[model samples]
Target chain A: MFRHNTLRYAVLVLLASAALFQAFTAEYFGLEILTEILILAMLVLALDIVAGFGGMVSLCHGALMGVGAYAYALLSTTAGIAPPVAMVGAVALTGAIAWAIGAICSRSHGIYFIMATLAFGQMAYSYVFEAPIFGGDDGLGGIARLDLSFVGIDLNDSRSFALFCLVVLGAIYGVSVLILRSGLGRSLTGVMHNEQRMRALGLTVWRVKADVFGLSGMIAGLAGVLAAQHIMYISPGLLSWTVSGEALVVVILGGLGTLVGPLVGAAAFVVLKHELSAVTTYWHLVVGVILIAVVMSRANGIFGWIEARWGDRIERRLSDTTRKPEAKEVLGDA
Target chain B: MLETRNLDKSFGAVHVTRNVSLKLERGERRIILGPNGAGKTTLFNQLVGELTPDSGSVHLAGEDVTALPVAKRARRGLSRSYQKNTLFDGLTVEENLGLATAVHTGNATQLWSDSLAKPEVREIVNEVAEQVNLMPYIHAKVSEISYGVRRQLEVGVALATRPLVLLMDEPTSGVGPEMSKGFHDLLNNLPRDLTMLIIEHDMDLAFDVADTITVLNYGEVVFDGLPEAARGSKLLKDIYLGNWEDA
Candidate 1:
């Protein structure tokens, strides 16, 4: 009888509780890992917005995140702006930049679109690597966290900062879910499914793609802000095409369109990388093997596989619970 | 009303559309009959702004939209269904209709609200579903549906846009005779004032639904007249290889 997505809500609750538990109980190193996973999860979530739903597989998301991180770092250190205001300005700037890129790249489709995004990503990476004001390859350090010390929350502490990142990630996940259920999400899905049909139906398909890309960029920017705070440094590596490629890998390894899957994917990816790299420097090869296995065994990814196994059962149970009383009432009436 | 004048398109010496001029008044049903490579689809493309004519103009509601893009032309009340089934196969039949209606009603960009929750979009989706006789399969995924149902959905999506001029390219291209008759009935039941330019191969459907007929051969309009006159035209008989009497 309840029309809400019970299973999705349940999964979100479970993930949130787990994140909170880790935030409260994790050690310093554990908190660092958790914060890294949360930030990367947010970035992958942003990637999914366009890649999974909008069918625009962008390779410039890492660069977009870099723009946010650089902007936040510069505004706080050089421009002398406050951390929170810099965060907002960085996100807006990244969104504007991504919107322009998306508008230009919208002219290309499929492989061409991917190449166009790669070109943009490489351009950003090269600029950041060569620019003297950015300290070139050395990157900029001494970036501050979103100072909430006046509110009695010391973000300098790992636990407090991790909790803050968890909160931001949760908010982003919630907003993403809302966007997916909204009209724009449906339009994006329609555009992905049949762009020609969308155009025939009077939709400016490129505009829709560009708008979603901009929204996705803002989310990636938020992730970038959190990431800079987590590391207290900004580097050109953040803008590298390899970063974009890795994010794309996480998106696929988790599952394409499933929002929560990307979080699971990011966590799995970070944990795997951390654990494997401890033993072997050739962790990329091992991760690649695992990715291949996941892609082969489950086309939907690990989260999708989990949902495929249990999602229907949970939905049916919820509906059954609601329908029983209605059935009884109908029987009594008859 | 949709009108095309002297629409000529060539692909490097091969003329796909040759001096094709046509006019459809308000509330008119014009059926285009042509064999393969006749450039009927090309003509429709030019009219809908998918392919621009080399030296011609397309007008919709007395405005020349020859320079406008596909979406802009569609916004000015020109909509088309593809010869092939071009549908959102990932979505349900109702979602397919809802998306078209959402875009048509200017609610496509609304990011905060549910599109299907809007009463206007739902109403139009339901209406178009009923119009296409797809109410029974409204909840079915387009990919899971049969080929014939997809054909109906292709038109349903176009109708949901609430177009002033609807161009349907082979709405019943592959259906059996029985289903084709049903599709014909569906077309006949549509609102009389909805102007339509249909490219059809079936003579039974062509003669049955057409108020006027235009025959295309080698990218040129060979004959254009009333259906009764088209039936008796010697040129049409020659083009059809005396298949006129079979209908």
Candidate 2:
């Protein structure tokens, strides 16, 4: 287990260093893309908590992030609240909304659950699109980044803001790792594996689902806050079902349950979208084909492929125990 | 410690569990014997709160738990093993046991630390692993284990919950005679104070482990008495062995 964790953290450290390098040396557009990747990575990480572990494929996560963005935008712009304070309020509001959604959706499973969340996402999108208070279809803007000049940091600068986003993303990633290794994570795994057994063993399965959903929402909301600040805009588009679909695609493209893989996925997705769009108007088609290829080539996604190929080799070197016999036994069973 | 009153269930026109009423005292080990489609598992489901009775009440430790959900009833010290293997196939055996022990000990809510690191949970996991004869396979994934070992794990998971009343559905359903014999020993070695209601097709195991036996046929209790009395019942022989003398 220690060896496994060491390999995971080693990869994380390498990614963090690369991100830090980009934050320090990248141009304005490059920093913008890096920040975008970080924000979406956070959102995907949150989605993994429910879809990957809790076994609930939510289609309303993009809407949940939009709710956070709007909450922050409105609280700061209309209510005249501080940006940091607004962020807290936004996350809390999103978490509560997500908890309610989870409680209701937990009653259904599989396709029904997906349809239910899609309905909620549509409702949120429609409300944001038509509501006059949210500037109608025009969207809300002029949102300012958190003022941290007092601490010898200037978030208004693109470099510092990108670095700040990276730090927050890193912290959230750390928390996600901690959560996946905790007792609650074990319960979620149990729930995911066999809901009947979990209930038989006395676990309140719905409660575990709802709790993880709420926590996931809070993380997604944090991502929303960063997105709004990064782009200085909030629109109904952010809450659209397509955004949810894209996030889900990125999740699968990276690897569903492997936390670090989502980060890699988010980067791959953003880069592909940007690079492909520049080449052709049929960028969506190209992206679709690529995703299909990825899924077909590796059902467990890119990270899973990597883990399958080299993860054991690294672990074998790190640990003294010979797992060859057991591995062979597993293969025979399969 | 577990009792059911007038439990009735029907799927469409077929009555699965007829007005089945039973009473088991604390520390009582009762064996439920039945043939195919006899509603043994249906009765176990109602008792565990998985299936609500069409019209009846279930009492656990003197409280009416008919309205309680499955998990809530389980939290109140009621647990059961599935007739089929219902294990976490992707997790190691120790994780399965650790999860059950954590839930039982109210440590499932811990979100910051490893549950198996807790001395109390580890102690119970080790103890239950020993009890179920699963010590050797504790580190093995459930998917990679042998069928007989998986059967043992089914009971091991139930025992890990430290249940006040355990309802096991066909614990030895698919095992060979040799493994079944070992299973019989395992059940015999369990704590005398732990109440168990086991559904069994193995007559020898039923007669061996049961202090009392309740025979079910066509969803109704045909006889409820001592194992010796149940063994001698002509009605049970007719329903189960089917008039072997005439044959």
Candidate 3:
């Protein structure tokens, strides 16, 4: 229902409102970093697709991001493909891998699924680490920037690319929002509560789980493609389980499935990492402490708590009429 | 019509079911009465495809379903409720019943469809909930309700499956006497085509409702007959009073 998803749509509107600040003279130097934060938000949103909505505790989402990054890096550079083609290719590659992993790993739930996804991620990491053509441990360098062919914009310039990344993030968020607000998302909520009941309901719980993972992976992969372009390089470490762990941490910190929770979490992570690492040798310690505090103090998450405060007001509105683009702002169940 | 033939199960040296065989014709009410460790639960598990019998087979409506998984068996008109309520703690009563509705129709894969949008699904759930008389507290959470309500939730879960053979494990193990009638009424009104094998300890209810009674003493049938034949034989009281009662 559009009513349930009002907050998500509002967050989208708020994020889009960032374009208004682009003209501000003082914001020029900070554009690239903020753009990176937005992309990170996209990644966190993708992670939430599985962990929060589907109840899959995946630690391999980062590796899925790696798949996208690799696809972009290979197609855009080595394969001499255009950026648009590379982007589509990246999504296809990552989404396929996500589906495969989801199908196999979804057979096991709770901690077992966690370990299975981790195992697959580690396998991807190892493949990237040892493959000679991929530059091995040194990583694949000399990755070219996106060439629009007709837009006539030089992507090497920081601000133009930052805007591009932000736009892409917005699109990805929209896609994720659409999927989560659909009938499919409701079944995912059911899975989170009780799988047995779901089976009795005559649901093929595995397929729904696989589909959830694939959706999240596609979004994560899209973010990864953008990230590789933004950084102009691809590394084997992109597929590391630690990166997946970080994504999981972001979802938790932001609050699981709370629409804008990922954005807040990404901002917290990016800002804290950039500012703290510049100042202290033990930056992770501070981030770790913050994480502990967030986890301990807020089970519903930052945005979740916000929703809980005024959820009654949102629930009062009826949203039986969903599935129309005109009602995107309605978010009741969208 | 459900039947298990020569079903044998064991846990290492301890045999849980030794050549146990039973059958329930369509519309028949069969109660299984046994001592504490007489493999009643084991038999239910085997029938529901949660446990594999070491030998022999199970048939539902004349179709061999010995190797089917639990959910698969459920799909083929076979449903069983846990002695312990397996309801999800996080969901409200309506949602749980809604899930049961989904199970009944077998559409567990619709991930995110807004429940309010599905008129057909809502109608089915409302009908079943009405039948079970759980409409009053449909929106209540499982944890917020009483033991009787919890049991009904479990039963509702099985009923949602709309099975041909309903297997209930200790349908009234911890229920108050007043709550028992609700269950009795619910069961009494069930379609005659839906056969049920109930495991229970209450002798009064067993005699009151069961058309056929199977008594297990030590992982084996001590008495298998009609309730009158079971009650007339000394073995009926012997299961409760030990060897001295039979003497």
- A110-151: candidate 1 lDDT, tens digit per residue: 999999999999999999999999889999999999889889
Model 3, A211-324: lDDT tens digits are: 888878888898888889878888998899998998888778878877578777887788788899899989989988978987787656766666666654564453445433
Ranking by lDDT: 2, 1, 3
Cα lDDT computed for each candidate against the true fold? 0.88, 0.89, 0.77
Better of 2 and 3 by lDDT: 2
The C-alpha stretches of model 3 lying farther than 4 A from their native spots are A1-29, A109-111, A141-184, A196-205, A257-259, A298-300, A304-334, B103-106, B243-247
lDDT by residue (B1-247, candidate 1, tens digit) is 8888999999998999899899999989999998788899999998998888999899999999999999998999999999999988778888889999999989898888988889999999999999998877777777667788889999999999999999999999998888899888989999999999999999999999999999998799988999999887877877767453353
Model 2, runs deviating above 4 Å: A1-7, A320-334, B243-247
Residue A3 of model 3, lDDT score: 28
Fnat per candidate: 0.76, 0.69, 0.39
Task: Give candidate 1's error at residue A43 in angstroms.
Answer: 0.4
| Cα lDDT for residue B211, candidate 1 | 92
By DockQ, the better pick of 1 and 2 is 2
Instruction: Tell me which of candidates 2 and 3 scores higher on DockQ.
Output: 2
Docking class of 3: acceptable
> In model 1, how many backbone clashes occur?
0
* Candidate achieving the largest DockQ: 2
